[model samples]
Target: MRTLTRPAARRHIERVFDATVLDVLNSVDLVDLRVVVLQGGEQGGPPAIAIICESLGQIDLGWIETGDAPVAWRAAAYRALDQSLGRVLPIYGYQYLFDEIAMYYWDGETEDDAARQSLIAYHGADADELENMALPSEMNARRPAWMIAANAAASKRLPTALRRKLDTLDRASKALGGLESERNAWNCDFEIIQDYIPGYEECSSLPPLTLVPFEQFARELDDIARNGMEMGFMDIAGLCPLPDADRIDDWFTALRRGVQLLVAAQDLIRLDPTQL
Candidate 1:
């Protein structure tokens, strides 16, 4: 697959993030609360979102009792932003260097640690003091391989017993043309097994084993499975798109390494669950 250029990647990032924000805002219970989008950073950068508390200090926290209240709205905004950042950023190839979210308050007048820390703590940074706050650190060039392994392991839906049933078929599909008979048998077995996997759509269509080679079909299936699995894992992991251009490939390399580690880990786990 072709990688996206930086500009196209940023556009994709903005579009997905905008959708995420809209969904979050629509769910808010307040009537007057609005989310404001402003151009962030220097020329040619993605927009930053702010939860506009129109009346600010005058807001009747009591009347606005739902999750859209000043406190909750800000919380929700950060949540949406963080979740979007975590999931979308990586697709274009980027990873957050740090865990803390950034904020620019009072019309972007000041950007001191006190302000950052207060904002972070107010919105749920678990730190006792500004010194302990972790909001404004630099982004790392690469993500740890373990994170990708975690993503893969997290995406697995089949139990060990169920997955084991495909061993013969999977092995046959890997070998030479001797697997024609094995593929046909696997197709039949998959028809029955796929049904037992409640809500699993992956194995729904068993392209007649005679029409297309099992190896070809397997590649197609793998693409579909990887997309679904990664999306699910990213959502749960709270990763976002990497805005920085320089380190995108580094992040991708880390992700590949993570996938490799995950496959190895799975093998080990299968060999001896107790030892692992």
Candidate 2:
């Protein structure tokens, strides 16, 4: 890892943590469901819970909550999501979407006077010189993953080797998915073949684990999904230097490690919480 100051490193870790949790929520089709359900009826539930399961069909939600295939999928999803986010986010200048929002609107910075003063401080120029600069509202929007990646690529923060690896993995994963779909269609028209093929084993979905590692991943995801809004964004720009190539490399290493662990765990009958 890059030798960042303690607070800066912590900020990066927290961002990774939040993104990983969100990734898990999305993977299990639970992005729209509440992580923790309180005493209130569903209709009168907390705002966080209200939006939970909004993206899921009733059937999908039921499977995740009660079925073996889905629960195991959830565990694997957690690992994949965590790995992907940890590797990807650092590439994009070590900044997150929330960081953009915080710059323009959060923490009582809504007023023109406050914002002007802040901008003046940032640019270290007089108000007169900064008058024609774009307002934060005009410039700000949530940065999508692709946009972040593009920014990193533009700045040369994403190394060539890492880029090629990411691209290769993405294309291979898509090809496997396509193969599965084609096979399913063929099975519909003909007979099922018990033949060996790379990734064919993945075609047979595993049951969810009843293990502690799975539970821990699920629980952490639940907490973040439910209470992430309560956690404010960091002022990374003020506190930390823009991430350089070395920092980006650190994130890439972390992400690869996460993916490797996830691949190993998915095929296992047992998972230790300690490993997670």
When superposed on Cα atoms, how far off is each prediction in RMSD? 24.8, 24.2
lDDT of 1 at 245: 48
Instruction: Give the per-residue Cα lDDT of candidate 1 at 41.
Output: 33
Q: Report the C-alpha lDDT of model 2 over 1-276, residue by residue, as the tens digit.
A: 559999998789668855754564343321222222123322432111111112311112122223344233333333233334222111112123223333533333545566677767765757687667544453333322222222233313334433344444444333323432222111111111112112323321211111112221333223322322343211010001112324433333333333333333222223322233
Q: How close to the true structure is residue 48 of candidate 2, measured as C-alpha lDDT?
A: 16
User: How do the residues 1-276 of candidate 1 rate in per-residue lDDT, one tens digit apiece?
Assistant: 979999999899779856755554453232223433444333444333222222211112121122222333223222222222211111211121111122222122134555565655565554455445333332121322222223222113434532342343233223322323221211123222223222334422211111111222343334333444443311111111234544334333333332332232233223332221
Q: Please list the residue runs of candidate 2 whose C-alpha ends up more than 4 Å from where it truly belongs after superposition.
A: 1-96, 99-148, 151-164, 172-226, 229-276
In model 1, which range of ten residues has the least summed lDDT? 91-100
Top model by lDDT, which number?
2
Kindly provide the TM-score of model 2 when superposed on the true structure, using C-alpha atoms. 0.20
How many pairs in model 1 have backbone atoms within 3 A of each other, for residues 3 or more apart or on separate chains, i.e. clashes?
12
Worst 10 residues of 2 by lDDT: 233-242
| TM-score for each candidate, following the candidate numbering | 0.19, 0.20
Instruction: Judging by TM-score against the true structure, name the best candidate.
Output: 2
